[model samples]
Target: MKKLLLAMGLSTFSMAASAAMVDFNTADADGNGAVTMEEAAAALPEVSPDAVAAADSNGDGVLTVAEYEALASQ
Candidate 1:
């Protein structure tokens, strides 16, 4: 019973962490389905442009939802 309680607690914590993710639409100011460096800055001032560049997995100078989620998850 104690082990089951511990597992439930861990799952709840994981869900809470995932729920705290940054909003992709708010970051994508242009509504273009991707976030440019400028938009990312506006949404996450602490995040550097270099970080955004690194998150641009497709070399498109922008971050897709998947890319942004990957960065935020880190």
Candidate 2:
């Protein structure tokens, strides 16, 4: 699954089943301190908005590296 996700370049993920961890810096794409919705979508195109929101514990509208890490763990 990890290889598949890598090969597909951030396709939809089954979070509960996922082990294809997201690399924060790689996903950030712009070197920004946080990952915005656009950045998250760009990194994981088919990932659900609800999922992202769920991961954004702070509700700050952007995912800090820690937030992103939490998202990946989901």
Candidate 3:
């Protein structure tokens, strides 16, 4: 149980670190206020098209920093 807890904690920490490393400003690429699908895709290759679509909750075809951060955290 202790080992499992430790592993989980480590996983959470790593996810947080990765999310922090890629802030919205840096990922925006074009210096726009929002991150486009292309920018999000480029920043997170592991994320699927569906995931990107889901992250864009506003349906504006772009991810705000908060949205991108949330997606990265996942």
Candidate 4:
């Protein structure tokens, strides 16, 4: 049915969107749970250190997965 096809299409789209999320491992080169400015720079050269600092929601001088995702989304 058309409805079933639409549901399958929507599910596929959702899966693709989730898959497009940033890969934390790529940014966390040292296998740390968080990313430092140096690691972020390696993965995202277009981003500035100041921007990474601003994205550090916890003021811990590093970025967790959530923080990194927020920066990537921007």
Q: Which candidate leads the pack in TM-score?
A: 3
Model 2: lowest-lDDT 10 consecutive positions:
11-20
Q: Go through the candidates in order and give each one's C-alpha lDDT.
A: 0.72, 0.73, 0.75, 0.73
Residue 68 error, candidate 4, Å: 0.5
**Which residue pairs clash within candidate 3?**
none
- On lDDT, the stronger of 1 and 2 is 2
Model 3 agreement with the true structure over 1-74: per-residue lDDT tens digits: 85465446545655766533555765676787999999777666667989989999889899998888888788
Better of 1 and 2 by TM-score: 2
Ranking by TM-score: 3, 2, 4, 1
What TM-score would each prediction reach against the true structure?
0.67, 0.68, 0.69, 0.67
Q: For model 1, how does the per-residue alpha-carbon lDDT over 16-42 read when each residue is reduced to its tens digit? A: 654325578756766899888887766
Q: Candidate 4 on 4-69: residue-level lDDT in tens?
A: 654465456546664224367656767879989887765666678888889899999888999999
- What is the model-wide C-alpha lDDT for candidate 2? 0.73
What is candidate 2's lDDT per residue for 1-74, written digit by digit as tens?
Answer: 75455546544433543432657876776687889987786676557888888888889999999888888766
Question: Could you tell which candidate, 2 or 3, scores higher by lDDT?
Answer: 3
